[model samples]
Target: MSTIAAISTPAGVGGIAVIRLSGSEAKTIAERFVRPLSDHKATYTPFVADGDTVDETMVTYYQAPHSYTGDDTVEIACHGSLYIQQAILQHLIAAGARLAEAGEFTRRAFLNGRLNLSQAEAVADLINSTTEASNQLALSQLRGGYQQKLKEMRQELLDLTALLELELDFSQEDVEFADRNRLLSLSENIENEAMRLVESFRTGNAVKNGIRVAIVGKPNVGKSSLLNALLDDDRAIVSNIPGTTRDTIEDTVTIDGLLIRFIDTAGIRHTDNPIEQAGIDRSMKAAKEADVVVYVVDATDKENLNNPNVPKIQGTTILAINKCDLIDHINTSTPNHIYISAKTGTGLDELKHAIVAPFKEVGDGAMLSNLRHFEAMKCLLAAIRQVRQGLEQGTPSDLVAIDLRDAIHHIGTITGEVTTDEILGTIFSRFCVGK
Candidate 1:
């Protein structure tokens, strides 16, 4: 592989910036800037390019077979001046190192066996993680917890396949080398495990991507005020005028280590105005797709509250009777409703608890956050089910062996034992430059 270089740190000024290089020429290109230092140690020295001093820098080197990319690697820590960062990167590029693409460094690590595909993805997730739960999820994957689980599942399938295939060698003898009852039992076990992982996608997705909650209601029902109250900041525009929010406004807030994205959408009411109607259409769509829906109703408006026009929702819905301060007596007709004043911040705590109530019982086990993994597990479950059904029907060992191999292949794609260039390209492209 050719040598690659990129700015590993964020752009703009900071205390320090890092420019990284990997491949056979990594150390050599780095040596051109700072004097060569002992491997695995940092040396502070002046960086020079084109016979002119660029900046005083600290350089660290790691030799092949032991570094992140499993190749010779160099990290140049320079002062966080935009000019200095650009100058150093240009110097390396001129010195035979090409610019690194998005996730190219991690891709090389995956190719060189330094990390499995899932773990490589975790590296990107760790960088992009917003909440503490997301951080923990990424860290667990980085530490090989996810990889190990998939590995165990694959190994079990492989073992079963091996035994089943061996029986084919003695077909002429009509000798049963493996017990049929045991094979069926093993197939059932693998299927159950795969399905369990498949079931975790819902909770895992919420943890990784945050719980999506849409604040939906009719015109001027305090939907924007409720959003501001939940976020504890004026993130949305509030006004007495109906249809103030003509588009969906979104922001994230962490509640009990879980990120909750509250989307304040346009008031849901019949309107001839194309813009407001479009916004209302989007509001319904947002509520439909959200993990939780907080339907805000004006408690002071007795006519609307008594006959609430609640849309048919798909997920868990929490009734939030807003503007309680205006009401003389908070007498809610609905039994499972929380009355709150978005302006005065009254009963906000009860509203928050109601939002996360459904997902609170989801345990902290290995879960599937990535859609690719979930789909693979679903495919794996289908294949294993085929194996189980074949075993029950007393089908020939060779036919059962085919489905077993298919199951193994599905599991392999998750950890990248089986992969295509298109899938790899698509997965890595989502990462930012120099990951």
Candidate 2:
């Protein structure tokens, strides 16, 4: 492969900037300006281009087969001046190094067998992670936690395929190479796991994006107040006037490491006005789609509590009684009820706990966050189901082998054991330039 080079660090002026080079001629091209380098050693040298010293920088070299791309690599740490960074990059490129495409370094790493496809995508997630939960999720995936699971399932399919093929080879001899019932049990376990990985996309998506929680109820019931209180910002206008909020107002905040987006939607009430009716329609949709719906109600008035339009929520529903400070006593008859005064911040912490509780129920395991990986796992799960059905029905061995091989292929796609250039280009193109 031809040599590629790019600025690896973030754009703009910082304390320092990194420019990286990889491929067969990386080291040789870097040596044009710097002194002779020792492998894996950082040497401070003057960067010379056009017979003029551009800047003094630190150069580190990594020899082939042990580097990030399994190729000769060079890194230059220079002062973060835009002019100097560009000067050094141009010099390197002028010496036969091509500018790298976005995520080319990591793509080369994947292509060279240093990292798998899922892990390569995780590198992007790790870069863009905004919260601790997201960071940990990306780190866990980068460490090959998900890859290991796929590897084990692939091994199971390989074993099953081998057994079936052997039975096919001896069909004329009337030989039973393995117990069908035992294979079924093992395959069932794999099926359960594939189901698990597919289902994890919910938690993974919630973490990658913020968990959705809609503050919904009749108008003027402190829905906006609750939204502001949750975000600790005056994100929504709080008013005593009914229908003051004509549309949904959304904001995100982190509570105990989990990111929750609280949407203050227009009150759920019938209105003859087309504008207010449109808002109500959107409010209903938000409540239905959110992972958790905060059913805000007034503590002083019980009349607006009964509503026929509250969407049927499939997820957690918290009946939050606002204006609790005004009421002398609290009532907690509902299953997931919380008494809170968004006025004085009373019970806000408890509300936060209740909000993050449902997200924690996804359990501790590698989750499917990337959409590509999710699609691949869905295929894998379907293939596993097909193989299980074939084995249970005593389908011909060769037919079972076809399903088994398909299962194997899906797993391979997840880990880059079987892939094409188009998929690789799409996956790596999402990354920032230089990584």
TM-score of each: 0.87, 0.95
Q: Put down candidate 1 lDDT per residue, 137-186, tens digits, no spaces.
A: 87777777556767777886687678778879877777776677777887
lDDT of 1: 0.86
Q: Residue-wise lDDT of candidate 2 within 323-414, one digit each (tens)?
A: 98997866544455688999999989898998898666433346777788889889988988988999989888788788888888988998
- Error (Å) of candidate 2 at residue 140 is 0.4
Worst 10 residues of 2 by lDDT: 302-311
Alpha-carbon error at 399 in model 2, in Å? 2.9
**RMSD, one per candidate, in order:** 3.1, 1.9
